[model samples]
Target: MRPFEFHRPTSLDEALALLARPDARALAGGTTLVDLMKLGVEAPGLVVDIGRLPLAGITLESGSLRIGALARNSAVARDSVVLSQFPALSEALLSGASGQIRNAASMGGNLMQRTRCAYFRSHDWPCNKRVPGSGCPAREGANAHHAVLGTSDHCIAVSPSDVAVALLALDASVAIAGPRGVRHVAIADFYRLPGDTPVIETVVQPGELIVHLDVPATALATRSGYLKLRGRASYEFASASVAAAVKLEGGVVAEVAVAIGGLGTVPWRDRGAERLLIGEALGDAAVDRFCDALLAPARPTPDNRYKLDLARGAVHHMLARSRPC
Candidate 1:
């Protein structure tokens, strides 16, 4: 790791000021940041330790679950309110790393975690996400783990956050604090597609700090669930994962939200495709049509073409499992 100045800020304002510098990076749990620093993928001049800030609270208010950014993944996953009201969110958190990692990974850090694309993590490979305009060897190289749904010529790296997918499905919002003031960004708009500038992955500015996330309490969230499929069971990123919530009325779909991870540059959600299932019974035909519409925009490379099938099956299974009998 590179030599850097460390500052343990005692307040949010102090942390914000420390992070205002372009070459500074925040350390919450250091689960992802420390690994990236060790791999030489990240070398910030200043490491601002924001873990001491008073941003680690999980509360429910006005029918919305407010999760402080510094809340540990394990705490959130095991919270009674989260397990009862937003089980999908809890499940997604548990499906992530291991018990130890979940204990240390913060909610904000999980959202800020970088992609696990081999090319981007390695300096030896020319990756557009790592170095803009350099080239994306994953576009033609070993890309079985790369994305298919939100791929651009510049980058095909998948978004690797399981909790983000669940949050997207639950219609969550992120609160950010910056030099100007605080602002809330909808989960759908939080992530950016890997366009020409793949390095600019999220809407977060250099100086901004994610303060917390808000997930509205809804019937759909109560019925939600998450399913992750990977080569191994634990401590592995998803090859294809689904987070879905469905509400049924009169034996037909009344409300639904679906999001997929490990298959897109961002947590992929298609409200248009979801509209196809409204007012229809979630039968095989309806499920097939929804899946078809959802995956229609996918542009899978030769090596990762199987992800299309995996995602299709995952969507079908998750929707079925979440539907009320």
Candidate 2:
């Protein structure tokens, strides 16, 4: 990695001041940032170490979950309150990275990690996301793992965050602290679609630090699950995955929130699919309609038509398990 100045800050204000420096990046878990810098993909002049800040706690308040951005992935996954109240989220976290990496990875770093696309990883390849207007090589190359939704001609890389999929389904919000002040952003609005500027992946302003993740109380999430389908079993990125939280009352679905991962530029939420399951019983018909509407516009390349079936199966299987039993 290139030699860079590092500043460890004890206070949020101190951290913000360090982050405000031009080309300064935040160092949380150092899982993603360090790798990119070594690959020459990211070259920051200064790294503001926010690992010393008091943002590593996980608490339950007002029946909601408040997860500090600095909270370790393993900590969040193993937290009793999170495991009991938000199984889908816990499962998602547990399924990602390895036990060792999870122990070091932070929630904020997880949320800000860049895409895992091969084109972006290779320095020789032209990628608009890495170099604006350079051109996207994944368009006609090995794009089996590229995004199927919200993909523009400039970029087709998918956001590789299992936690983001779960958060989207649970209606979570991100708390950001910056020079301007603290602000809350809905999880849906936090990630941006790769329209023209694929390089800018998030809505966070420069020098912003993600403080915590705030999730509203939801009965559905308590019984929800996340299903990830990958090429291999133990440690591999998903080819397609589904995160769902559904609440059933009497014999019908009362509430349903669904999001798809591994197949979208951002964590893809299916509001149309959620609406289809609102009053319907959690059965084959409901699943069929939900899958059809959500997967209709998924424009997969020649190498990834199998993802359609995988995504469908994941949704169906998750909902079946999520149904009241």
* TM-scores of the candidates in the order shown: 0.98, 0.97
Instruction: Please provide, for model 1 over 1-325, each residue's C-alpha lDDT reduced to its tens digit, 9 standing for 90 to 100.
Output: 7799999999898898889899999999999999999999999999999998889999999999999999999999999999999999999999999999999999999999999999989999998877789999998899999999888999999999999999999999999999999999999999989878899988999889999999999988999999999999989999999999888888899999999988898999999999999999989899899989988989998989898899889988987884566
CA lDDT for candidate 1: 0.93
Clashing pairs in 2: none
User: What is the C-alpha lDDT profile of model 2 across 152-210, one tens digit per residue?
Assistant: 98999988999999999999999999988999999999999989899989988777889
Model 1: lDDT of residue 208: 94
Off by over 4 Å in 1: 322-325
**lDDT of every predicted structure (CA atoms):** 0.93, 0.89
Q: RMSD in angstroms, all models?
A: 0.9, 1.2
